[model samples]
Target chain A: MTRLTFPPALHAEWIKIRTLRPQIGALAAVPLATVAFSALAGLGAGDDDILFSAFFGVNFGQIAAIAFGTTAVSAEFHTGALRLSLAAVPRRGSWFAAKLTAIGLPVLAVGLVTGLTALAAGAMTVGPQARDATPAEWVRGTAGCAVYLTLMALLAAGLTTVLRSGVGALSILVPFLLLVSFVLGDVNGNAADFLPDRAGQVVLHSSWDGTLGPWTGLAVSALWTAAAVAAGLWRVRVRDA
Target chain B: MTSIDVHDLTKEYGPRRAVDRITFRVPPGRVTGFLGPNGAGKSTTLRLLLGLDRPTSGTATLAGRPYVSLARPLRHVGALLDAQAAHSSRTGRDHLLVLAASNRIPVRRVDEVLEETGLTPAARRRVRTYSLGMRQRLGIAAALLGDPGVVLLDEPANGLDPEGIVWIRGLLRRLAAEGRTVLVSSHLMNETASFADHLVVLGRGRVLADTALRDFIDARVHPGVRIRTTDPAALENALTRQGHDAVRHPDGHWTVRHARVDDIGPLVSAAGVPLLELSAEEGTLEQAYLALTAVDAEFAARQHEEVRP
Candidate 1:
């Protein structure tokens, strides 16, 4: 037997993602929409926190990440390509991990760039009266956005594994992100901090004045991501492909 | 020794069994046609062997080890369960490239397989844009990417045109000639009869017959003597008196059951009957398969009737 040393699963995932033009277009939409929408939202408001204003794109961009991530696995299930994937790499865990990694890295990069550009554009339009974000804020916001997008992608991927359908995964994820955050807004101040979108959005603020600290909010989001991924892993491992 | 060894494999869905204690071996250097009717569990069997779906009981080993146990599985076995299972947006070459990468196979090998499977012209085209035959060729290209010891293809001829079918037949023959164990599943026995040296006939998730092609044909098809003469009644009577069962048709030809043409010439000569035409009628593989499956079909119908009534 030939000693197979290729990263076949990872390579396959990359090819799968890149070949689909819609995925790339979706990834690009985050920054474009963030900058455009945030710029529009910041027009009337003056001298606001540049960091906070710049990240408006990520709020919308993360949706694209979620869609991309969900489809990464769900597309396979829908097309029945999971059989070919499993047949190539019988180790289910490795295949899942490779797919996560391939999708996670690109989403993270897109998130970071979008976050940084949004902040810079907001600051440019707001002029010097805009509270200049500290380097620490820039680092935190950009890095946090990247981490947040990665987690969301992973969460979407996990949810997709559980649902095994693209439309089904999206139906659940979109409502949780768009509607549930508002529904939980007036609940027990401390309790609502654990909601994934709430926790992830905390990364946008320059100050840690919320119920949970910035790091704690991010941690809570991470927890949600871990739980979702663990559930997905369990489903993949136990269920028939 | 480097072959697929499936022992007492069983797979169940809830309370219903899809594959029930089925066992078979696919040896190297020949194509083993996994023949069966629709819903006979051919795909389920391949899924178990490839570890896509776990067997409920027993084991399926590839090259003396379980499929999941192999660190680099593609190097051991390559399988194409569905031709259109690939991401429709991905190009054919990219699809093969991805699989090749996993097995540490060279990227150029993807091109080689593309050429080999005759998908070179459409290598750069998106898979969704390709025709069904092109997609099938692409799937085969992916299977051949690793140059593994064994290749498994399920319903590979499902969507192929006549020309494409002939191409696939030749490709399978060439692959088997190179000493690799090739297992192909198809519901059409006639298509398989041309390329398959050995056959494993399945029905209702069970193996009806596991034997060589020639043996299957011989066992199912009975050789009979066809004698055409003006005195059909006399010849029929003479053959029937000589302990051969003969049937006279409305077309004035006599068909002798369980007798060869060589035996009929001497029988007619000795009986003083002038023979106008005497020839042997060979039984076809199709007839044999129908005879074998007819019994199973009847049993299934009776079982259904008992349940419903």
Candidate 2:
């Protein structure tokens, strides 16, 4: 008999995500929504932090990221998918880790590509103001864009595992990301910066007035994702599949 | 050693217990039919065996290791708990491919299983478009993908056509003949009688019977002598004088309960009775199983003792 190991389980999860049509759409929508909206934000031209403006399409793009994360795990909760999955690999820890890894890698790759394309699209619309953006800022923004999107996707997947429903995870994350996060942005001080989305978006700005810096902000978001993932792992360990 | 051993395994969902302290052993080279009603916890027990559901107390081990602890569980134990467990949007081939990759099974094996299950033509179609029988075939293919030592299937014949049913019976028998431990769960005793060699019956989360298929029927049901003769009065007199209580039917045949044909034939001959037919009237598997698990044990008991001389 062959041994069930982490590497093969991860490969299996990757194939699962790659093959599903809705999951593919969710991944593709990340770049499409990001570049399209980043170009629009560049044309509007009122925001002082041109860096955030260029990456602003992430507001819409992150929704797709969360969808990808949610669907990847939520698919398991469908009729007998998780049972089949666990039957193939009985180690819940390895299977959950593999699932998250599969979610993180693809979004990170797509997020990086989306970052560069959105920056160029934003520069075309913002005119000479885009030239003021330095190489250091571009590198940081792009890296942060990729990492931040990946973290958010991981966060959604973690939540999906906890909720065990794609629609359930989306119902909470998507609306909260769009309405609650935006509304909270207008109402509070640095305390609002601690919210997962706001905290992670800190890196995209060329300058900031918030309490958190670039890496520290993403760290806060990572902590939230970690907590969600821990709870999800616990659920997988204890609950009936 | 047995391939699968479940001991004192219990699962309680709030106040109600789904599986209550049940124990049984599944030996290799035989098909053990897991027979139970819908709410009798057959599926729950299978889930516990596969480590898909945590047990309240006790243990279920495969070859002396908990399923989760096995190095490659699918390679050791293949299970089909639910045919609908596969996602509807994924193609049938991809579904098997994902499982094959998970256990490190080669990709070519996926095609082989598809062809084995007669699903090669529909392998590319999404599961949503497939019929129930196709889904069952897909599920069976996934179970056999690893070609594991132990096979567990639940209600495998639910949506199968007559040909599919025949195919499954042969497949199950062959798996047992190959010395693999096969556990097939169903509520139909007659269906299992065709393929299963041993039986593990459950009713209300408790083991009602576990033994060889023939013994299960033999122990619960008394297959008494069925005698036919031209002179019914002489045969009845001979049977009564031998201390046998024979029931005379309206059709002119006599059914002697708790009586053996070997002992009755000589008695009738000495009594100058000419026999037309002499045989044992064995009870059907369905009749035997129903008697054991019948809703009222008291009634079943009455039926059992109803054969008293």
Candidate 3:
């Protein structure tokens, strides 16, 4: 048998995502919608921390990133191309890792840019309300948003792998993120802060006083991401392509 | 010898058995045609060989090693299972580029295969825009990218035009001539008749026949000698008296099977029969495949009836 030594699967996966129009469109929509929504919201609001307000749209924007990540794998299954991918790279572990890296990097980039742009634009619009917020707070918010988006993207990728269908994965993810989180927040009060979306949302705050601290919230979200990804990897490894 | 060895391969989907104790070897340096009717487990067998699907209780090795055991599998084996099994959004060139990268193949090799498969002009176009024939060509290009020692293609000529079919036939022939093991699965026996040197005939997830093309045809399809004589009655009577099975066709020609053309001339001459034409009718691969499948169909029907009662 010939020894097969292919390049890092990440490079192949990156090309796979980058060339697809839907993924690019989803990535672009994140920042554009974030800045636009934040600017419009900042215009009507009082002189507040416009940076935080500007990025309010990220609450919705991350869903697009999640959708993109989910579709990356699910679309292959939907089109029956997953078999070909397995044929190309038989190592399921490497293939899943590569897909994670490919999806995580772009969503992170878009999250950071959108978060920062929303902060900057909101601060300029809100005048004195945005004052007193330190550069450190802005940096943390931007960096945290990127990390949150990356984790969320991975979570979505994992769910999609297990479900093996874009529509099925999205049906579960959307309600959980949008509706279930809200209902659970009302029911459990501060306890709901541990939920992935709420926990990850802490980093976007310039002011303190969320149910969980920023770092702790990020950690909680990371745990969810890890657990979901592990489950997905396990399913992919054992199941037939 | 760079052959595919399958041992007790079995794959079950719930209670239904997609492949059952299927075992066959595909030797190198020849086109081993994997022939079966639809749903006879041809694709499933190929998937097992490539380790794309987990077998319930068996193993298939390529070139004496499990496919998953090979670190760089593309360098040893290339496969094109489905033409449309590609990311439609990527351009043809980029699709091959990514596969080439995965296999550590040189970027130039991508263009080489594109030219080889006559997909150079459409290299820049998105795969979604490609026609089925073009996609087939692209799939072939991807498979040949590494110039592996073994190639496996499943129904590669499904959507190809006549010209494309001819191109693929020549390509498979050339690859085998270069001593590469080529396993191609197709339901169209006629299409693979001249191209395949060996055959692995499958039926109901089992190896119905695994033998050389010539031997397969000779055994399953009875070879016959066609003699057109001025006195057809005399030729038929002579053949019948000699205990040879000879049938007279509506065209007033006597067709004698299980006999050689050389024997026919002497026998007719000895019987004092006037012979105007003596032609041999050689059996085709299609005839052999049909005969083989017909036997399987009858056996299956009988089994079904027995179980129902």
Winning model by lDDT: 2
Model 2 backbone overlap count = 1
**Candidates ranked, most accurate by TM-score first:** 3, 1, 2
Output the chain A TM-score of model 1.
0.91
Evaluated at residue A238, the lDDT of candidate 3 is 97
The estimated TM-scores of all candidates read: 0.93, 0.92, 0.94
Tens digits of per-residue lDDT for model 2 on A115-220? Answer: 9988888788877888677878988889999999999999999898888888888999988899988777645355878999998998998987778888999999
lDDT of 3 by residue, A125-204 (tens): 77767766777887888898788888888888988888877788899889888897767643434767788988888778
On lDDT, who's better, 1 or 2? 2
State residue A148's C-alpha deviation in candidate 3, in Å.
1.2
All candidates: DockQ: 0.60, 0.62, 0.54
Q: Looking at model 3, give its docking quality level.
A: medium
Q: What is the lDDT, from 0 to 100, of the residue B292 in candidate 3?
A: 92
Error of 1 at B135 (Å): 1.6
Give the per-residue lDDT of model 2 (tens digit) for B221-294: 88888878899888888888889999988998889897787887788888999889889888778988878877
Enumerate residue pairs that collide in model 2: A80-B85
What would the per-residue lDDT of candidate 1 be over residues A1-241, giving only the tens digit for each residue? 4543336678777877887888788778767876887787678665245666667667677788888888777877855688888777778888888888888989888888887887778777776755577878878888888888888888999888888877888999988887787677535467667788788778877765568767788898989988888888888888888
In model 2, what lDDT does residue A126 have? 79
Candidate 3 residue B166 C-alpha distance from true site, Å:
1.5
